[model samples]
Target: MRRTDVAEAWLGVGTAALMTALAPLAGATLAGNVGAQLLRDQQGWHRTTAVLTENAAYTETAVAAGDTGRAEAMVRWTAPDHSVRTAMALVPTGTRAGATTAVWTDAAGRLRHQPMTAHQAEVLGDLAGACAAAGVCLVLVGGRRVVVRVVLDRYRARAWERAWAEVEPRWTHRHA
Candidate 1:
């Protein structure tokens, strides 16, 4: 073979080998980026699911408390699967203690009437303490369940805002 032809052949072989070596690396880098994006998506999904689950639990507890005629500042629920759940709550009433405000499901899952109680104020205080610890606030106004509007300390609010901003991108709905 001519010297020039031999040189050309070697150059082509070297180019082919370089491409082969880089191809897998390039593919792997692309795959890794896609995998990371998928992981983030999954994490967002899990966070959304967790928020939905919490809302469902609170709703059930409120329904149960309202059904029992014992509108409380908090409700503890035991799921059919025997899982225990609790949440801060509120109940409103227009009348005095012992008055029936509403009907609620009892601990046994049976329907029953709930009467207002004098101990509610004490319960509300306890619930407030719990809410403070949980970064939330609770109040029973008019003997009804209501989540107190959270007014964090200024320093805490900044931190909360930052954290909320991070999670805000993942949330599509507003909490009431």
Candidate 2:
């Protein structure tokens, strides 16, 4: 009968509504940040279709996920300034010298890592927001359960004590 609710009724409704609304809002904010980062990355970066200039110097097998095999090799690409540039790039193992690969570059035509696409950013952001919302909900529910359990246990303990007191006198008198 004692109120041991972790959150008031209005507070629970408010939290639920806020979480529902903030999920999309957080996703949107994260998406915007992704876009800003991509823009910053693009400032000095460009993509070039380049060809390997020599046979794979050596093949490397990575034990890590998504990075199983790689061949380090030199590649040639024409810069935006109409100059030919050669840079070291990673390619599939056993690649022939003339195999073509996509290379990202900076304003100075230096090789740079590829940037994530807009779709990837959006998807990642949405997933993050959903996970955060779920975590919040889980914490709220778990807290409420713990509080309710403690309150109920206390009430049950009081009832058990009262019942035992009534039976204890008769048992003691019989023994005497």
Candidate 3:
């Protein structure tokens, strides 16, 4: 029961308590922000059918990489404003010109990727929360270990100095 043992214990407990309480709060906030962003993305994106403007033949490099069949090619689709929009979109391999293909678009009628679903947002939120909690625990535990090590090192050094002090004078007198 060293004098600083209580201090060390308190430091560890206090750190753990603070982290356990605060980490989840911060995590939840960040997760909520992420969910909100995903909601915005879902609202901004729209799906539409497009036509292949050219042959979507598979490239030699893609074939060598074991591409099943799909490739990217230019396609045209009518936007929400009924404006013509043409952009590169994924289509079946060897798709000929004038073939219809489905695509997604943004509010501006530009070709866009699919939006994240609610389930995907939930999963992402959970992952972010879990990572934050885990990271907090890891950092707190490591910091506590460092504190404990420093306290114990001081205790051991003092013990060694006291023991040496008691023996040094007696040994010197005996030798003389």
TM-score of each model, paired residue for residue: 0.24, 0.50, 0.71
Model 2, range 64-142, lDDT digits (tens) per residue? Answer: 4346467668999988888999988877767788889888888877788776777776676566656665666666666
Q: What order do candidates take by TM-score, descending?
A: 3, 2, 1
Looking at model 2, the pairs that clash are 44-106, 44-107
Please identify model 2 stretches exceeding 4 Å from their true place.
Answer: 5-14, 48-53, 57-71, 76-88, 92-95, 98-102, 108-110, 135-176
* Residue 91 displacement (Å), model 3: 2.5
Report per-prediction Cα RMSD to one decimal. 29.6, 6.2, 3.8
Model 3 stretches astray by more than 4 angstroms: 58-69, 77-86, 149-176
The number of the candidate with the highest lDDT is 3
* lDDT per residue as tens, model 1, 1-176: 54444654565565456545554445455445544544343331210000111121224565665663323443444434466544433344222333222224434433233432335434544444444433311111211121112322344567679889878877956553
What TM-score does model 1 achieve against the real structure?
0.24
- Candidate 3, TM-score vs. the true structure? 0.71
- lDDT for 62 in candidate 3 is 72
Q: Write the per-residue lDDT of candidate 3 for residues 99-154, one digit (tens) a residue.
A: 88778788888887777788888889778877887787788888888877886677
Alpha-carbon lDDT, every model: 0.40, 0.70, 0.81
Instruction: Pick the winner on lDDT between candidates 2 and 3.
Output: 3
